[model samples]
Target chain A: MAVSVLTQKKNMPAGNPVERLLAATADDMARVNSLILSRAESHVDMVPELARYLIDSGGKRLRPMLTVAAAQLFGGGAGNAVNFAAAVEFMHNATLLHDDVVDESDMRRGKPAARMVWGNKASILVGDFLLGQAFMMMVETGDIGSLGVLSAASAVMAEGEVFQLAKTGDLATTEADYAEVIRAKTAVLFEAACEVGAMSGGADAAGRAALARYGLELGNAFQLVDDALDYGGQSGALGKNVGDDLREGKMTLPVILALAAGNEAEKAIIASALGKADASDLEVSQVVAIFNRHDTLNRTLEKADAHARTAVEALGILPESEMKTILADVVMHSVRRAS
Target chain B: MAVSVLTQKKNMPAGNPVERLLAATADDMARVNSLILSRAESHVDMVPELARYLIDSGGKRLRPMLTVAAAQLFGGGAGNAVNFAAAVEFMHNATLLHDDVVDESDMRRGKPAARMVWGNKASILVGDFLLGQAFMMMVETGDIGSLGVLSAASAVMAEGEVFQLAKTGDLATTEADYAEVIRAKTAVLFEAACEVGAMSGGADAAGRAALARYGLELGNAFQLVDDALDYGGQSGALGKNVGDDLREGKMTLPVILALAAGNEAEKAIIASALGKADASDLEVSQVVAIFNRHDTLNRTLEKADAHARTAVEALGILPESEMKTILADVVMHSVRRAS
Candidate 1:
């Protein structure tokens, strides 16, 4: 009863970091949203229709928010930040469209995935369309330095996704491999989003580097929390089913830790369910029980908290401001979501 | 027998324009090849493995040659031409990968598609990796104007693909739609390749526009020939089955013209075969017989020839050089391939 009460209280946040960040960046974000909508448009009907489905789908748009917020933190009031923010969101949404196809995902943002509604072909092409528009927006900014950051990040993100695909369902996948995957597939975009934002905002060298580090750490923490939530959090909150990563044979931290700790019987049970597309809810529950027995979820959350702390600390170099404080809180709240 | 003799003579060119162009730009092309190979590489083994399989699979390497040749015509000797050339090739290969996935193509360049070898997921990711690398190379050149040209072309190309997909099997698809499709899917890249090459080569405004129109017309000719060859050329030469466009339900000029002219019985036969993945060789031949009755293949090639003439005329503004002669001959030879 005491533990349950503690969990309930922890889940109830006194202040919502995302809401605060959104409020703080609302003015800039409106421009970002408009840009995202316009850039996603195409003369091809399917291009705009499919793109709008994913773009207008209730994504948190956190990556672009980070871009805008980072720009604001450096006193950026120009048009470049808006462009960069829109481009970052396009990159994120493009990846989402492709990721859904790669993962054979059925739902995204609490709705049927674009692939499901439009088929894998549409998903793949629209993803490419969005990616092209993203670069177009970046080019419109006329900032080659920031474009370089985003382009390199795009390559690394694809590599991370490929590497993760190769390692999928391999029980021997190491923590190092997982780290590389998250950094490439998830964190690098966050890093680029912030770095480019800072660049657009006219941040000095040190300021830019600080924001990059902050973004990288936050991305790492964010992905770690996501991995844990896929097994521990509610489906309603996640906009996806629990144990999806497990079913997909994703060698996430919780599963890696559980595999390392569990006995032969437990390992066999987990392996049977891993990568089984039709993995039953009962099987998922059984796996979660094993994860609980090993305390892997909590251990994963601990790792996430460490990353979140580092992310907050990375911003220490920046001059204190309301935006900076909100940014730090966003990192903390990212990890706390796993509770 | 006379028609067959004429076809054989037309097919066997006394001097291959592609070979001539290849020889003309050998040094630049060597750099382009090296850049393509190096840029396609990644720490992720699968990235290079899949990319190289397609890149090295004996594509005529025509687009990059166009880039190189366009640059050479301007009397420019600089590294940016090489970069843009390689980048154009990367963009082309990336599209090939995604196109195979979208089209569910079994063979490319007389070999199994990357999607067939590594699965659709790998093809999509590696294609993305190549696109990212392409942009990175463009950024490295620090030529934002050319980058803008290529990036906008990328968006338009994607739109072209999506439009083609939507109109597949619609039967109501028009000549204008076919024109739009081929321009978007094929010609725009050629336009960008040449335009960017001219820009990189320090061409004057008129020179650049002329080269752009040249590439655009050449691309139209190239794709028109490709459509005809899909029905009328040898598989060995086309590197794909006869009637693949029909099987894919692609409303190319050949098919659209035939459909518009065919009686109801002929239309029924074509409709039965259109979009049928398992469409037999016998069915393909039947469709080809109908195509011959209407002489649609020759008409498509005639259209291609017109575009080829326009392409050559577009280059009339430039000073005569060995490269310009070879470029104009390349367009003529592209049309002749379907004879």
Candidate 2:
């Protein structure tokens, strides 16, 4: 098995790692997608309706795909991976629903957020429904260790959100604080997703730790790039309006770096626009110009690249495999999306 | 043990069944309380702040008490009950936080709702955090069976909330629909709480099933009386304004009964008040007057009494014990609260 995987890695496909991971795990993910939809179903019409709306919405299902890939990396394609993958997706979707409500975001995936369409109350409750369903799926797997990982991740994710909420609109928000926020909110789940998937795949302790480290670093890179993209990428490509993080007063790395380096006038420009829901396009452009002047966007991308490198390096301890190679490339691809 | 319990039951001294249950389970409950507080703590200031506010608020802690009592009833209380009990309370509090946000309720336990003080976003997030913690605690117990019970209960509870949301302000709601909603939203958790408590207490299958049935019926009685009290009980006693259900457009048994029994003119009066955020005291009184004319409040109470009777009867198969007696009385006391 090891020799075959090593042979495949030498002639790896030269395209998007995400697409490759998807193709490799398509059969497993097919089961995962079905389980996700089936579990999201409820006797209550609105639950399935709202859940399906968000589930079918254009999320790359990247998190779940990573779970499958990690599991497959460990020679695991047994049924447990499918359950963990579905649970991970539900956790992600649950966060998205709540985050939209928290950020008061109008758009998600270039469509009106579920909160906007169904109202915040529905969004909040349905988010909860998804979360409850997530735990239920995990419990069904009867994998207490993985359940522990995911549950702890869920709590940390919520803490990250609360911490971010507390720091919103505070210009004194430090880069360290921003890092903690992102690590808690985004990267921790990635770490758990990969770790749990590896566990499901029957990875030994060392292999599990390596995948966890890889996932954590990759998640950090993934989020850093996303934060950067929020400012630098086109709205169409990002599937969310640029300046949303700014408008939500999210103290992402770009804003943190910009605030650190900006002069008094530039700082004033960013402050005026920060957390202002109705901050006009012109005002946002002014903030963006200051960010450009400070080159904070590029600087953020640099940090993401560093994390991506660490993520790939984390994979070095593992034996060569097509899935492992694909995982490494996915990390690089995540960072490169900013460019 | 059975003989000692039987002796105590013959000489049982109790004024209120709730107080009796509390005293009986006091030692175990202290541990459960501590677990609840410690688990609710987070490094993030607001997470604990909001959680403490809700936890410290004057909730009767009835759900957790039930868990403790049920465990004790089955000749168990080694340690698992404490975890299950705390998890039960967290689940209850999580739902309370979310329900307040969804209902736009201003008051809970005679204080400003957590949403009112900390904002809906914090409530939603903290609620999620508590729920995550709940699952984490359950995972620690490593009891997959209990975890399954609790997780499935959580999903059912969410479904109940959504079902209730959809039926809100719909005058066409039937008693059967109302029963389903309450079962999902309220009774299901109670059922699971007792069942899991029994499991942790090392109960055999029959005992577990009996306790579960007792809990379900008791929960039904509890909610039925609560709904009745929403209109008939005083604000101070209820810890919330009377007619809250009416203003929130909750189609409880009382409302469903009143609607089915009211004349055209009375129906118009109810339709005007239903779902009206600013429903005046006079308008509420007019609706209450219609309920009085049809005796819908008492009718609801009568339904509660029936459930309470069944709850008590479910315990008949168990060996005679003080805890069993107290459990039966608590069910009666729960319904008696309406008067």
lDDT of 2 at A130: 86
Badly placed stretches (over 4 Å) of model 1 are A1-14, A234-240, B1-14, B234-240
Docking class of 1: high
* Per-residue lDDT of model 2, residues B1-339, tens digit only: 111122323444558888888899999988998898899888899998999999999888888888888888888854798999999999999999999989988889888999999999999999999998999999999999999999889888988998999999999999999999999999999999999888888899999999999999989988988898888742213233888898999999878888898889989999999999899888888888888888887777778877887887889999989899889877867766656
Clashing pairs in 2: none
Q: Every model's DockQ, to 2 decimals?
A: 0.80, 0.75
- Residue B98's lDDT within candidate 2 is 92
Which of the numbered candidates is closest to the native, going by highest lDDT? 1
Alpha-carbon TM-score of each model against the true structure: 0.95, 0.95
Report the C-alpha lDDT of model 2 over A121-218, residue by residue, as the tens digit: 88888888888888889988989999999999999999999999999999999989989998999999999999999999999999999989988998
Best by DockQ: 1
Candidate 1's residue-wise lDDT over B149-240, tens digit each? 99999888988999999999989999999999999999999999999888878899999999999999999988988888888652213234
